[model samples]
Target: MPSVRRALISVSDKTGLIELAQGLTALNIPILATSGTARFLASQGIPFTEVSEYTGFPEILQGRVKTLHPYLHGGILAPRDAESEAELRKYGIAPIDLVVVNLYPFVETIAHPEVSLAEAIEQIDIGGVALLRAAAKNFASVTVLTDPADYAMVLQQLQDRGEVGEETRLRLAQKAFAYTAFYDIHIASYLHSQHAPGTFPDPLLLAFSQMQSLRYGENPHQRAALYRSPLPPAPAIVNARQLHGKELSFNNIFDLDAARALLQEFPERPTAVVIKHTNPCGVAQGETLCAAYCRARDTDPMSAFGGIVGVNRPVDLETAQEMGAMFLEAILAPDFTPEALHLLRKKRNLRLLTLPLEQQPTTSPWELRHISGGVLLQESDGPGVDPSSWRVVSARQPTAAEMEALLFAWKVVKHVKSNAIVLAHAGQTIGIGAGQMSRVDAVQIACMKAVLPTAGAVMASDAFFPFRDSIDRAAEAGVRAVIQPGGSRRDAEVIEAADAHGMAMVFTGRRHFKH
Candidate 1:
């Protein structure tokens, strides 16, 4: 087959546009591009025909209708076969062999702290989808590039063979299809969140754009990458810039996200969470931000070593002084005082990030898991537990001090990996058991690790106990009270066990399983 002769170039992220355009021009391919892209090409001394000249129509609607013309679509979608070529010639259409296109600045535009509704709506692209689909549909004969990361490989293939091969073309086509699908999912999610619901509903649409391929996962053999949720522009996992330290692994990213999400929940309050292996090692709230950090650090001093710490309030000098005494992998806060930043900056290996706390938290609609062959999806179990409606089911109602500890444990337990158990006394964690196969096992592990079993400790379970056996175990370990979502059929047996042991138990009517 003859080499691709015509290429269209358009992009918002112009990372490798010049290099790619140069390579295409070197191969004698005629480049056609939009107004800004065409001007850029001209400035760079790369030859290109304006898209309007090729399509015989000016860009209208303030550039919204630039690439939406049938001439552009017909060229990209036209097959290279004799009949398709004859038909295109009959209709005055030229075959477009390659499409290098990226959508508008939707992600950046919506990420602003106070973006208006009309401004957000305007960021969504129309012609970009048409260009992607047209090129992707004719993948057998055309190459479509949507990501800047693919530029190097595509240029290498074109350099070696004067054109991208069929295999490379197919791979690019697959990427284009997935890219467009994710983009549409994001638009659907945004519209649903902003508009009235119809009879046919897309209740949940969660899409992530991969930020980077990591060195490996938790284990070096497993592959992983940091991914950000589409288009909303929260200072989420994907957007976190690593200021220092080594490359982030899968476990690090997981733990960081758990800590960050919990911090977002209490932006107006002074709160700190120390997370290890995607579970809360310690979590505390206090009057001052420094006090909160100190309390959280004291909760599990040993476990906090090399763990991620997240703060809801600004990090002050006092907090930084305390943090500098120990080692940490990462620290995230809404902001940091100048003195605090100066002190913390001395620890060059620590990754520090400051995020603008959102006025209202964006809730995820569904949870997803990728199996070997497919993916599993379900609704998100986001903060379903109501604190005010909880009932004291045990014979002995919890004292005020015990109630405070229980509430603290309740929030910490929800973010821990299941099957999870947390033991707290006063305002700190005494012991924690995480990622066990059984609930009873989790209880035993936590109790075994406790510094003082009889220290007026309260227990928090991530989910309802399937049997009263776990409650019995907690009672034997001198647990004063238990907090758990009471949804199991045998909840009566569990409550009776607590009562028999003269322990206070609260049923939250909600379960937090963090697997």
Candidate 2:
């Protein structure tokens, strides 16, 4: 146990301050506080010496320089060794045995969309951070606390054992450092985002807050947690409300993201997407949610077993009743009607997420993937394909109706994994082949899985066919038109194959390769 003879306390959020101060006073320890905290303590009838009085130096710069004096830092940072004691005696500075400091609300300040840079910078909290660092570095003689929630535990320990233990002190010191580190990260991220929006700096700083601990990762042996951006709430899966569900597993969240990404692409009409293993299995658009969901579900009901579903429109009773007939792992939509909610709630373990359909994620944010020794950072994949940029590469031009189906398949293929192929007719997917090692294999699998006639249907590929074999296979399956990003080694041969089959093909300059 370590004795706390003198305690310094200063906090912007003063929850439970009076009780902690009372506990410390009962233990016969004096209190030191800053001007604002001192005023608060005085109003509560808890006596405390002002930090200025203890330092013998008046605060300047409109209180920005408060508690930054050497007398304060020296008291907190000095070691308990003989040399430190001698130096403290020479300076007539007493050692501070405890420090309670929480940084100003920089995260909360920037959450306001209208907040200015000056206001956010003002909340960076220089003196409070310095005080916390000094106290934490000398934990051998001091107890540091950054969260008011810990006050009750520390108060109980002080009353029962007469002092805080070394173990508790060590934990508190670690927490204090983490608090300041996250605060500085938020400040740096905000300033950079304001000045250099999309440019990556030499040393990138990421600000994240842990939302919850997951049950496990993809495997039982691995542990994982979910973290989200420190910025204000946006239209995101992270900000979605889980209305009814068992806790989301890592796999469930991944598939939900895939489904929602496709749902955003066709928000003008009711859209439905079914995803499995982070790859879209089926997709469709209709005037009603029930019609869209049934068409999407009918594409590959076998593959959609226990899959995640995303819809761009509110779910009514008819849609909910149709969805309830399937064994789905989760459903995400903008809203659910009362009848829909009541019917769906019967499936107690179903995961239902609600996110508004109107909020488009137009701004690209930093995306990261963890490696063994380092991390890889990249911007999100580019925006929707421009219709004017697509060129007719085959001799036979795609009919107006074929163009509509081709574009619809093109949008759906972007959400599938690499080496992906989608077959669509009438704005709904007929079959999909994803995550194949070869493009020809994906084409074959997609044609094999089609329950409806492939004749007059359109085909979309994530990337161009490397050889003419994929185009030959698509033509044999009666694919009337093809859409792909044309940059293959044998582009002329592939176009010749399409022309030989009297098929129309369009080339998008950009490729959407989702790993």
Candidate 3:
């Protein structure tokens, strides 16, 4: 049998500690505990030696100086080897073969609104980190327990193998490192925010929690995982726990996040957006939500197959019937009426998500993206473009009716994937081309996808066209007007092309790239 001799137990939370201590004692492992833990063990009729007794000194400095001694750390960290054993015997040190420790209640203390700054600062632990690092360093011979959920697994391993395995020790060590990193990030962010309120820091503090393991990435063979920001009171997409469905693919979660983010932009109005892949296929607004669904669906019925739909109003029976006739992978709305709920229940595979409508803050502090072993952070695009800020650089300006269509198309174009071209007539999207490699190619594709020939439609480009080729192509497709953020050196050439075709043009001086 592997020698199970010494164990160190220290904890802020007392739940299940006595029971675990009793189990360890029954197995002939000596439990060395701190002051409070020792008292609890004695009260429970479970025997344990005080940590101060083992270290040959009483705890000082208001019990904060107990576990910082070299004797405790050396026993936990010393490798099990002949040379080390000889040194340990010369110093009369007994190896700490097991360590059970949990950090102070920093998260819990800060969670309470009434906690003062002094109390919160005191909750930042010192001894717990030392104990964790020591135990992790000697993980080859010691089992370090941190989370309460690991109790059963450790007990089972001790019961089955008579000792913890090396593989399990390494895995636990990795978890310990991750845990410490997360804790340090929280502290650093809190202190930095308190010190610097408004100014942007050189490096941002971004933290994430694993949400799920996906079936695959964008393709079938690539591995993928989903992570959400560790903000208190989760956002809609992050808080939405999947109750039922096949495992979500990475692309599925991306589209879902896009749909939710856009809908959060408009909470008071009845609107509908149809998205395929990562681009908007159709979008419409109406007084009655069912009317909006009708207009949005008719925008591009052919491309709506297997797409995702998001609505800003409660779903009604009439709208549900229209949705049920078509094939859709998912639908999200503020709520669902009883009849609508009954109708949607027939489509067993369709994922229905209902979130209570709440107004989103108009500003965002930061946005983040994952890179290999690092991350990129920047500010998120907060509000929609205001047409009053636009400048008319073209010789001929857009009429009031065309200006309305241009602004409407501009908002929808922002959510479409890069290399985006959208054609709008009146208030509805007539054509959308996205994710192509060239601007002119996107224009041709979008015009070809138009339900009508686009004789009177206005086109919105997400970014400035590098050349005038895209404007010429749009003119050939019978586009009546054009709207793009004007920053290109060849802007005059593109404006001339629109003027040559007797079309109206406006420049918003704002770019909306969704890459």
Candidate 4:
């Protein structure tokens, strides 16, 4: 292949544009740019020929027709063979040895809170993606770069070898295809989302970008990698900034997700959740974050050890100092005061993350779980309870405070694993039993886990009781109220047991089995 003699450059994220242009110029490679890119190069005092000037055709249709001319593409896409050379020579086309073009930020454009369809459509680059694909197709002869992060390596290769190697070209070509494919997927998905509303198409196009690679999956022998959608699904931990700490491990991510999901349940209040093995062992909402943390931690101090903690409120010095008392694995909150960050950073291995709680979306994206042969896809169980929809099934109705505790417990149970039971009082979980095989066993475990008095606390079951035994056990354990989705064969018997104990019971008609 011919050495790189000329290069085309256009990029929406102009991160390394000037440096790349300078390097190319130093290598005596002339740069061809268009519109904003040309202006940017000129402003940076880098010599570049505008594509319109090179093609002898003025940019039309608001800069959309700049690089579509054969003058530009033919130079980049032509083969290195004699026939291609003859065609290039006949057309007086200078062979473009490199094409560095990142398409317009369609994903970023649509990410705007108020971005209109017209605005989003306008950001789509017709020529940019075409140029990337054309250069990638002729990777045997030309190099294609769709990421600015590749600029340093590409320039180093050019500077060292006077040209990019075929191997490197092949790698860049593969990346370029992936780059354009993800871009197109986002565009198509966005357009369809606007046109079709709630409907998912026959072939669902899910676009994901790697956030990071995990050390392992659930166990050290398993492999795992983390990827995220193009757009952050509001109140996302993926978008959170790690202020200080060790890298988030697979277990950390799982536990943090569980804690954050529960934290979102009490958005307006100062909420704290302690999660271990992807199950909330303690959760509480208080007037202050420190108080919430204390209440949550106090619920099951043993389980809180080395567990991930999540708080909906910004962490202050007091809270951080309080947290410093325990050997915690990680803590996630909206923000932390400088003093708090300083205090927390002392624990070198602790992971500290910041999330914006107010930005959580009311509706959620799909939840996907993989099995041996297929994926289980379902909507997230985040749309919370409507108290008015809850039917009081027992002889006694819940008081105002019990109703609050019952709703709070109900929210907490949704995040627990199947056969779950949570006992909460005054918006805090006193005990929790999750992933048990039997409802009665779950109730017994939950009662056993309670460090505080279970008396007058509300019990929340993810599903209806299979028998009256669980209800009777809850009553024996001093649970005054119960919240569960009633749809069992013996629901009437369970209600009768609650009535027998003068305990208030609510039927939600909606189950939260998370197995």
Q: List the residue pairs that clash in candidate 2.
A: none
Q: Where's the lowest-lDDT run of ten residues in candidate 1?
A: 196-205
Clashes of 2: 0
What TM-score would every model get versus the actual structure?
Answer: 0.75, 0.94, 0.83, 0.95
Q: Flag the better candidate by lDDT, 1 or 3.
A: 1
Instruction: Please give the TM-score that candidate 3 achieves against the real structure.
Output: 0.83
- When summed lDDT is taken over every stretch of 10 residues in candidate 3, the lowest stretch is 239-248
Q: Each prediction's Cα lDDT score?
A: 0.82, 0.88, 0.80, 0.89
Candidate order by decreasing lDDT: 4, 2, 1, 3
Candidate 3, residues 1-515: lDDT per residue as tens digits?
23557999988888878667877887888989998888989899998899999889899988777899878888888888899878888898888988888888776677675878788888888888889888887778888888777777777778777798788888888777777777777777766756885556656666677877878899989998988655544245666544334556687777776777666655656888887886788887778888888888888998888988988888999999999999988887777888988888787778787655455533446666899997777777764567788987777888888998887888888888889899988777889889888988889888988886688899999999888888888888888888999999998888888888888888989888888
Q: Where does candidate 4 clash, by residue pair? A: none
Which candidate do you rate higher for lDDT, 1 or 4? 4
How much is 333 displaced in model 4, in angstroms?
Answer: 1.8
Q: Give the TM-score (vs. native) of candidate 4.
A: 0.95
Per-model C-alpha RMSD: 5.0, 2.2, 3.9, 2.0
Q: Choose 1 or 4, whichever is better by TM-score.
A: 4
Query: What does candidate 4's lDDT look like per residue over 174-286, in tens digits?
Result: 99999999999888888888998666554767778998999888899999988887776777767778888888888888788777777777777888989999888889989
